[model samples]
Target: MTFTDVLRYTAFSSDPEGGNPAGVVLDATALDAAAMLRIAADLGYSETAFLTPRPDGGDGPGGRGFGVRYFSPKAEVPFCGHATVAAAIAVAERTGPGDLVFVTSVGEVPVTVARTADGRLRATLTSVPPKVEDIDPADLAEALAALDWAAADLDPALPPRIAFAGARHLVLGAGTRARLADLAYDFGRLEALMLRLDLTTLQLVHRVGATDFDVRDPFPVGGVVEDPATGAAAAAFGAYARELGLVDADADSVLTLRQGVDMGRPGVLTVELRAGDPRIRVSGEGTAIPTT
Candidate 1:
């Protein structure tokens, strides 16, 4: 028999029921990939975090470093932002909020946890260097068809592209909030397309204000119909927006992403881009979910 301590946390919201929930394992030194996958599948969240302390006593006080792995119910993912936040907060609750370094499949990620003015813990993760690529016309058409969205329903300004920070996400900008809402996509179709493209999610967004937007992610590849609050997609969208000059790319700017509203689990994600840096910063609050 194998014993594993799994912690439940909701990231990107102060309310436990209002954010994306993730399973977090603080110490997974003894678990292998099969075990981790089984644990994640059992939890049935979009992604779960598994952490093993760095053998070298890597960084931060008392060598606050870990080798973090993210797993969806069906498979392992390169990186997961919300899970990272949950894991960071899980550690901070025990060791006090501070800086920590995580060696992920994508790269080394630096995270900072601090207490907010309202006395809530907030975690911010800096993403790996990101890049944006234009999607093939046929692929874009297929994706739109799967989502039941026509070209006219898309925002001509944002354009479609695949963006990668820690993970690859297809970014599609909706022309209107109504278009962004009413998400009814073909699961198998989207999953097949995502698998072919090696995509983690489809970032469907609608720009409300200059720096404010509503976003949704279709994560069929992760065995989840939809992701309530997606930090990875948010990071990728930030990179795409910057590259397209949708936001100020030459200066520091912060963008607000409102997600999960249509799903009734509303959550907010803050994305920051600094001048002269290709990396994106995603920040959100996480709370532990009381288990019975």
Candidate 2:
């Protein structure tokens, strides 16, 4: 019988008290779908990652490479950025920092891990090519109603759209940071709309600068009230901002996203965009959640 080694790591922040927490099963080859889901549900974090290494001597942490699947407490998701970072750092801690590949349901993701001079481990995940689309007016109204937000509360410059990197996110920009911080919504109504539209989270954002944003995600579909430091949505937002000509497309840009302040778990996510590359890169530091 094989035992799966499970650990908890927080992504996008060096402090364990900050960032988003993820359950990491470095070895999950023996587990079936039911077993994995059960583990994830019992953990009750936003998401948990399961790894199944390739047969060619890839069964160890930071081995050659591995196949990764992400599961929320409720259901499996296509991709999860924070968990990806958490897993990468976990592997790098054991095998040293370098490049790693994750064969995900969406596609192959290339991640580079490195240790900083300050003794922090950070990982960057390049997302699949992102796409931006228009959302129906009815759907938009429904989302606003559920959140008790008026259409006038939206930032006219940013607009509203559906963005996709590895997973689908509904992007709505708030005119003010205060609006972004206040988040009390109808969970069931939002969940129903998210299910119908296949949305992973609602990316509520307020631009602080040309490249900095204060953001929040409502993830009722994931069986979580909110997500702190949502790197997946940050990647998708990079594409959305680029599409709207909010950022320079010809120059490499670094975007900073601040999240989870109101919930008291402040975290930061760094999003990078290359001049010609269509894929967005989301980077953040990860720290181990100490066993208590």
Candidate 3:
């Protein structure tokens, strides 16, 4: 089997200590599914992205793009924001800064990379069409039970729902920021429920201000307790806010998401919403992690 050099990077935050780390295989045309899974398992990151050149003149019907796939150690995911950012930067390192379209399992995602003033790389990914759905009360109860959290621990304002961008996630808002910090849960039970629900992660959040939120993600299905930062969830949250009419669509709205603070790896994600665009823009700085 052919093996390509993979780069490790954390996206959505400047500090290496922040953001979610993803394995980036910029070129994987020669690798198959089993090889990709093995690589992801060996890297042991939350997700790994494998990029292959699209067949000549096969970039969608009229779009000129490449195909990309994301894989966890256990299984393949439809899309992964952190892995997308890492792959964008990886491509930019060789191809220079510009637009790159990725054909994902869910849909096509357009990512743009630009060099920042401090000589850092910033990647912005415009998500596919997002949708939100009301979660069943019984499922919410089951989830709460799995997490060992009571109804009183949940924030009444935000409510709970299953939100989807490229993937599905259960959004749970905590009554207080402190409650969000304490995150001991039944790993096996939560993992089973998440698998049964086809959920990617549990987007646990706490509203600190009208435009600011602190978030955490429980990714038992991916064999991880918590993701440092999640861009897909941030995009889905933007859609959820728009669907709920929490922000004016005609105005430029920006939401700041603070994640990974409880895990000692703090990350900040900026979610942007434009009036005419249905796609959410998730942008953040990424840093390369040297492979040993």
Candidate 4:
């Protein structure tokens, strides 16, 4: 199996200057788990997606799409939103834009790719059934301790919770934009706690307005200090807001997430929630980064 078959692309934001970049292995049928891990490690991206043909008669559309697995340098994640978008566009480039289903460790995710009015391909992924719950006070305290932050630093409006869309994340809201901008954290300590909790990332956010927010993620468990832009977290956050009645559920709502500014790589994520639809829709544009 040659590694050349794998493709690389950035997702969520279009400029390559913005958005998260993920590695895509559209056909990983011949590669074992170890090989995939090795490739992910070599790529050194936050997450790399590996695709393998699903067995016939599974709960997907003819398996035209494959069973997808996501791996960071250090561990396997249940699912990754940015990588899924990257992989969807990669597949669309090869198989044409349409509906594709990915059987993931958490659940089945359906993604659709369509050409935008500006002639760019955009992918929208509907998250698996989502759930949100309150975070334990002790756990929240531990998280705050690891970040060297106090309860006062938290945003009272957004609160904190553990949310799941295809993966688990602890959603934390900073009290002010300055608090969000300051991101010094104990990486090793946070990683240990996150491993115990099976958390993929800590979704730290600061709301700029009712519909606009700035976000950041500390993904130490994934062997990264931070993710440039996180799609899965965005989906989970949408669910969190709906579950908390932070946003009205009767109207079609769109939320804008700005991330990665501190790291110098900025990204934008558009999250849509339709009334009466339980699923969250995440849409973004991706551009290929030219390799040296």
lDDT of 1 by residue, 1-292 (tens): 1224999999999999888999999989889999999999999999999998875666756237998999999999999999999999999998999989988988888999999999999999999999999999999999999999999999999999999999999999999999998899999999999999999999999999999999999999999999999999999988998999988888999999999999999999999999999999999999999998
lDDT of 3: 0.87
RMSD of each: 1.9, 2.2, 2.1, 1.8
Tens-digit lDDT track for model 2 on 211-232? 8999999999889999987888
The clash number for model 3 is 0
* Global local distance difference test of model 2: 0.91
Question: TM-score of the candidate numbered 4?
Answer: 0.96
lDDT of 3 at 59: 49
How accurate locally, in lDDT, is each candidate?
A: 0.93, 0.91, 0.87, 0.89
Candidate achieving higher lDDT, 2 or 4? 2
**In candidate 3, how many Å is residue 48 off?**
0.3
Clash list (residue pairs), candidate 2? none
Candidate 1 minimal-lDDT segment of 10 residues:
54-63
Kindly state the number of residue pairs that clash in model 1: 0
Worst 10 residues of 2 by lDDT: 55-64
